[model samples]
Target: MKRLIPLILETLDRGLTRVNPLVAAALWHLRHPTRRGVLKACAALPLLFVLYVLVLIPFTPGIGDIRKAKIEQPARILSADGKLLAEFKPSNREWVKLKDISPNVVNALIATEDHRFYQHFGLDWRRTASAALHTFSGDRQGGSTITQQLARNLYPDEIGRAPTLTRKLKEAITAFKIEALYTKDEILETYLNTVPFLYNAYGIEMAARTYFDKSASELNVLESATLAGMLKGNSYYNPVLNPERALQRRNTVLAQMVKFGKLTPAAYQTLSKKPLRIDFERQTEPPGPAPHFAQQLRKWLAAWADRNDYNLYSDGLVVRTTIDSRLQTMATQAVILQGNQLQGIANAAWGSRAGCSNGKDLLATFLRETPDYRAAKDTGLSDDDALKRVSANRGLVQSVCESKTRVQADFLAMDPRNGQIRAWVGSRDFSQDPFDHVQQARRQPGSTFKPFVYAAAFEAGAKPSDTLLDQPVEIQLAGGEVWRPGDEDEPSERPITLRDGLAYSRNRITAQLMQTVGPNKVARLARAMGVRDSPLEAVPSLALGTSPVTLKEMVSAYGTIANLGGYVEPVMVTRIEDRNGEVLADFAPTPPQQELSADAA
Candidate 1:
C-alpha cells in the first residue's frame, strides 16, 4: 500500500505541474507519501478543481481570442457635400482615448477600488488573504482587482458574474491572460472605456457627457469624482435620479483620493461638502437633416450588412449619400414656409364651428378617435361620459385640433443628366410627422399629365399646329351610360391648334384628342416614360390626369423628359465604406434606356 501511495502521488504531481505548482507542492511530500499526504491534498482540492477547469477542461482558449474583442461604433450618415447628417448607434456609446479621460477619475478609481493596482500582477494576494479573513468572520468583501473586473466585463458569459469559487478562478485566469497581452496603461484605458454607466450610456466619454454635458477631457475634479463613484452601481448612484445617494458616493470617492495623496485634505474637506451639481442633460444623438432619406438608406445598408456578415451598428460604416446639403436645407425650408401658409389658411377656414366644410364639428370627430376616449370607454364609460372626461383636458383638445388642421407637403429633386437625387424633403417636420409624402403618397398629376398626352400625339406623327375642336364631347360607356366631358375654362369658342389646346389646359380638347390617338397609345407612352408601376386606365379621363401616381414615379417621368427621352433610376446612396476607408460597396444610377424619341421628348 505504501509503494502504491507514492506512485499515485507522483502521477498527480506530474499532472498538476503543467497547470499549477502550488497544488503539486501541497499534494505530496516525497519523504512521507502516505495517508498524511492525502490529508494535505484536501486543503488545496478546490484549487486543483479550478486548475482542472482552467487548462484540462479548456472552457476557453487563450489571449488570442481576447485580442479580438472590440467596442461597437455607430455608423456616420453624410451628405454629398460632406455634411454630417446623423449618427445611428444602438448602444449609444462614444469611445475616447485614455489620455482624454480626466486624471481625477483615474486617481479616484485606483485608490478606491484597487489600491495595489500596479503592484499586483492581476490578483492582490494581500487583499485576497484579508478578504478570506473577513469572509471567515461573516463580513464578505470582494477582493477583485480592476483587471479582474475588466476580465469579467470583457467576457461576461465566459468569466461569469456569479459569486462562486469556480467563476472567480476563471476570472483570475482571464485577468492573467489580459495582463500578458496588454500593458498596464492599455489595461486601464480599456477598463475605463468599457465600463457601463447610467442613462443608456457606456464608457467614460458618454457618461461624462450624459451627466455633466461636457466632454470626458473637460471634466472637473468634482465631476470626475461623481462619475467614478457611479462605477459601484450606475443607477444606485445616478445624479439625475438619486442625487442624495450619488452625493454620498461622490464624497467617498473624494476621501479615497485624499488618503492616496492625489488630493489635499483641505480640498477634499471643501469639495466633499459641495452639493452634486451636474448639468444633467441626458445625451442623445441628433436626428439631423434628411432623416427621412437616411432612414430608407439605412434599411438598404442593413440588408447589405446582413449579406456580407457584418453588423450595421457595430461595423462603423460611413454612408455617403447623393443628396446636396445646401439643396436639402433649401427644400426643407421651402416646405416649412409653404406648409405654414397652407396650415394657416386651413385653420382659418376650420377654426370656428360655423366655417366648417359640412357644418360638422371636426374637433368632436378628432376627439372620438383618441386613445384616452377609447380607454375611458373600455373602462365601462358611456360615449357621452368618455367624451366629457377626455374633453376636460384643454391641452389634448388643442393638440388634436392643430394636428387635424396641419398641412403636409413633400418635395424631391433629382439630377436630369444622371438621375442622382439632389434634394429630398419628406415632410414639414420629420419629428412631428414622420409620414413620408414623396415616395409613399399617391397624388393626381392634374395638368402635369397634359404634356405626356401631347408626346403621344407627336409620336403618332401629329404636328403641334394640328387642330382639334375645343368643345364638349359625349360618348357611350361600357356601363351603357352617357359620358360627357366638360371644360374647366370656356373653350376657345372655335377649333384650336394642339399647341393652344395644351396652353389653355382645355379638358374637352384633350379628351377629344385622346380618341384620335387612342387611350392605349398614351398609357403605353406614359409607362415607358417612367410611370411604370401604377395601373393606368385607358379612358378619356386619363388625358385629364385622373389617375393617382407616386411622386417618385412622376419625378422620374419628368426627369426622363429632361434627359431627352432617356430614363435612369434616381440615386440616393452613392457609396458605403468600412471604418478604415476601405470601400465596401459603390452604387450608381441604373443603366439608361431610351424610352421616347429625342424629337418627341
Candidate 2:
C-alpha cells in the first residue's frame, strides 16, 4: 500500500509538471512531506502565472495593430457664429484632440476613471490586486485602466466587455499592446475621443457641446468633474435629466480628485459648492431660428455632395447661407403673432356659423378621426366611449377645423440690392407642418397683382395720371364663353386716374387698362418680373390676380420693383467649405437682368 501511494503521487506529479512546474514541485514536496518546500512552491506560483500571461500576450489577435485604429467623425452644420445648428452623427461620435481638451477635464477623468493612469503601464497591478480581493468578497468594483477601456472601445469585437476571466485576460493583453504602441498622451487622446458620454453623444467634444453648449477646450473644473462622473452611469448621472444625482456624482468626483491630489482641498470645496449649471435650452438637434432654411440647405447639400463625390453626413462640410438669424427670428415672431390673430378672427366667425349648431356632433366626428381617440378605442373602449372620453378633453374640441381655423402664413425678407434672402419663415409652426409654404404653396396674390399690370401699362406709354374707365366689362373668351369682370362689392362707372385705380385695387379699371395694353403684353411683363413658376392666362380675370403663384415668386417679382426694375435671382446659400476650412465653392449674386425702366416700375 505504501509503494502504491508513492507511485500514485509520482504519476500525479508528472501530469502537474506539464501544466505548472511550481505545482508539480508542491506535489513532489507533499510526497516527501516537507512544510518548507510546499511553502516555497506556493510562493512561486503567482510569479509563474504572471510569466505565463506575459508569454501569451504576443499571440493575441489584433494586438500588434493598436496604433492603426480609426475613429469615425460625423458631419456638423454650424451657424455664422460657429454655433452648432445641426449634426448628422450616424455613429454619434466626434473626435477632439487631447490638446484641444481642457486640462481640468483631463485631471478629473484620471482621478475618477483611473487614479494611477500615469503610473500604470496599461494595467495597475495594485488596483488589480485590490479589485480581485474585493470581487472575491462579493463587492463590485472596477480596476480597468484608461488604456484598457480604450482598448475595449477600439476593438470591442475582438476584446469583448464580458466580465469573465477570459475576457479580462484578453483585455489585459490588448491594453498592453496599446500602451506599447502609443504614448500616454496619445492613449488619453484616443480614449477621450472614443468613450461614450450619453444619449447619442459619443465623445468628449460632443459631450461638452451636448451638456454645456461649449467646446471641450472651454470646460471648467466643475464641468469637467460633472462629465467625468457620467462615466460611471450615464443615465443615472445625467446632468440635465437627473440633476440631484448628477450633482452628487459630480461632488464625488471632486472628492476623488482631491483624494488623488489632482485638486487642492480648498479648490474641491469651492467647486463642490457650485450648482450644476447646464444649458438645457440649447437644442441638440437641428434647432435654431431657421429650421426650414436648414432643411433646404440639407437637400441642396445632399445633391451637391452627390455630384462632387462627397458625403453629406460624414464629410463634415461647412455650409454658409445668406440667412440673417436675427432677422429670421423677428420674421418668425411676426408671422406667428399675425397668424394667431387671423386665426382668432376666423374662429370667431366660425363660432357664429349656422353649421356649428351641431357642435357636439362635429366634435365627435373630429375626435373619431384623431389618433388619441383610436388609441383609447384600441385599449378596449367602445367607439362611443372613446368619443365621450376624447370630448371630455376641452382642448381637443377647441382645435377642431372650424373653417380650417389653423391659419398658416409665410414671410420672407430679402436684401433687394443683391437678391440675398435675409430672413424666411415658411410656416406658422414648422414642427406641425414641414411644408415650406413660401417656396412650395401656390396661392392667388389677390390685389397684389395690380402692380404688375400697372407696370406693363406704364411700359406701354401710359402715365400714372392716365385716366381709365372703371366700368363693368363684358368680354368674349377663347372657348366661346362670355366673361364679365367687375370690381369687388360694386362696379364704378367713373373715369379714374391709373394711380387711383391701382391704389384702390379697382378690378374694372385694371381690366380696361389690360384691354388697352393687350393681355399678352401683361402676361409677358409678369414673366419678365420673375413670375416664372406658373403660367398666366391672358384672360380678363388675370387683371384681378386670378393666376396661382408661389409666395417666393411674388416676393421675387416685388423685389424686382424694389431693386429698381432689375431681376436678380434670390439666393440663400453663399458658400461651402470642407472640414479643414478650405473653401470648396463661393457663390456670387446672380447678375441682374434689367426687366423694366425705373420710372415704369
Off by over 4 Å in 1: 1-91, 96-200, 208-282, 305-320, 352-360, 375-389, 440-446, 449-487, 490-502, 506-528, 531-549, 573-591
- Candidate 1, position 54, lDDT: 55
Per-residue CA lDDT of candidate 1, range 414-447, in tens? 9977888888888899888787788777888887
lDDT of all predictions: 0.83, 0.81
**Candidate 1 displacement at residue 406 in angstroms:** 2.1
TM-score winner among the candidates? 1
TM-score against truth, every candidate: 0.66, 0.55
Clash count for each candidate, listed in order shown: 0, 0
* Over 4 Å off, model 2: 1-286, 352-403, 476-482, 518-520, 535-538
Model 1, residue 389: what's the lDDT?
87
